[model samples]
Target: MKITRILNKIDRRFHPSHIYALQPDHDLLRENRTYREAKDIVLLSYPRSGNTWLRRLLANSILEAQQYPSSIQSDIPFETVVPSIYTQSIKPPCLHRYDEVCHRIVKSHEHRDARKHKTVYLFRNPVDTLVSWHHFVSNSPSLLQQFPWVVDLSIDEFCLNAVDGWAKHIQQTRHYKDILLVEYEHLFQYPHQMLANILDFCRIPRSNIDLDQIIDNQSIRKLKSVTHSQELRKGGVGHGEVELRPSTVTELRQYQQMLNVAWKPQVERSLMTAM
Candidate 1:
């Protein structure tokens, strides 16, 4: 028993994936305790659910044209404007000094809580999200180590699992009265309109915000061109039919039914307002 326990500890130390699964909440609390007081805007989503793209959009919208590049390389320093709580190595400035800034956006993928901070939850089709996530995790060595299950599952299995996962994510955050829910498909379909909505949700005046320029610069083509990884591949909706097998498609359809039932009212309301 002692030997087994010691081996498990050693395994977790060497394998980050095991550690993450075992102590996700503890890790999140430890890493994000500082930001509890000062988070101004919470950008919440499941992993691979358009968080990075939205961050780019928000950062570019806020930054001056010259300061924000047209084509962003993988290493662009936009974290100060829209930092991710999950990715930050040091203490987040937003936690200490959000009042000093005009807009502080913090990204997260945790389950929703009762925090009163303004939140924007991004929702993508689970089929597309899972497909993207699978490719993303499979391609990145670090991600593979952290999420070894991605390598073991077929695409259909992943989508079936992701359906349940995303449904839970939606159920958790859907009821937040102050939250603004944004659909990933709409962001692509109507970039100007969605950006305008997001800017409004963040309480930024659209007067000086050039929606045209931000949309053009942050378009999927431009983003994919600069991002040299599978993470940004084919950033459009309905690609799941192409990438996922027929069995996966059938399974995803059933999952989509559950998602629509849970999210239809909120999503419809958002779309109506956007229209």
Candidate 2:
């Protein structure tokens, strides 16, 4: 099987794809994009949140203006996708403080690091995030270890973590400006506008990018058919009870009871949301 991994902008010698940092620390040099020079527009999100499709659209839009520069884009994904082939890909190795401009397009599930870089944050209702996460990463030996709760988590327990938000504030925070908080629901409904916003964030020229072409683009289909297939579903509002066993449902509720009441509605809504 062919594993998909693409190296983004990074100084290969100093910042290998093996290491990762919350924010890049590009150093200075004559031939590289220093931290000051790294004009990055990153896509931030948790797993299965649809950034893959977003990134592709951005790539197509940018490539179109460039006019088939030399075979479109060679294959994207910087750290996250590249490391995924190993089965437990989490973060990439860190690079030196300079050469940050090596890859302009990047995708990561790691909580956002670079506090100042422009970012597009995508969030799914915690319920779906958790359910899909469990299904997608259930087989990942890494997730099993990182999230000990997952090993023996009852369905309810699973829901709690999903909604509790990731360690770095999936629920709320005020870290940086230029962030576009995109709920998963809007992405499917307004695919074009969503794409436009992303390009806008990246400061990418939008002249040649066709939003419709991207939605129907082969890469979108390719990703769904490949490793990312689990995400094909867009999600509804509620009713997981329909598919889960009574025993499992009971177990899930046990954990759900642990969350703050404020987040309950959101979590409950996503459980049944098929996306």
Best by TM-score: 1
Candidate 2 is scored at a TM of: 0.58
Report the lDDT tens digits of candidate 2 across residue range 188-274.
666676666656655667665565765566244354554444554434433355545565455445433443254446433432241
lDDT tens digits, residue span 27-58, model 1: 65456645554446788887788878888887
C-alpha lDDT (0 to 100) for residue 251 of candidate 2? 47
lDDT of 2: 0.47
**Candidate 1 at 117: error in angstroms?**
2.3
Which candidate gets the maximum lDDT versus the true structure? 1
* Residue-pair clashes per candidate: 0, 28
Off by over 4 Å in 1: 1-29, 65-76, 89-101, 112-114, 146-149
Task: Tell me the deviation in Å of residue 24 in model 1.
Answer: 13
What lDDT does candidate 2 reach at residue 37? 20
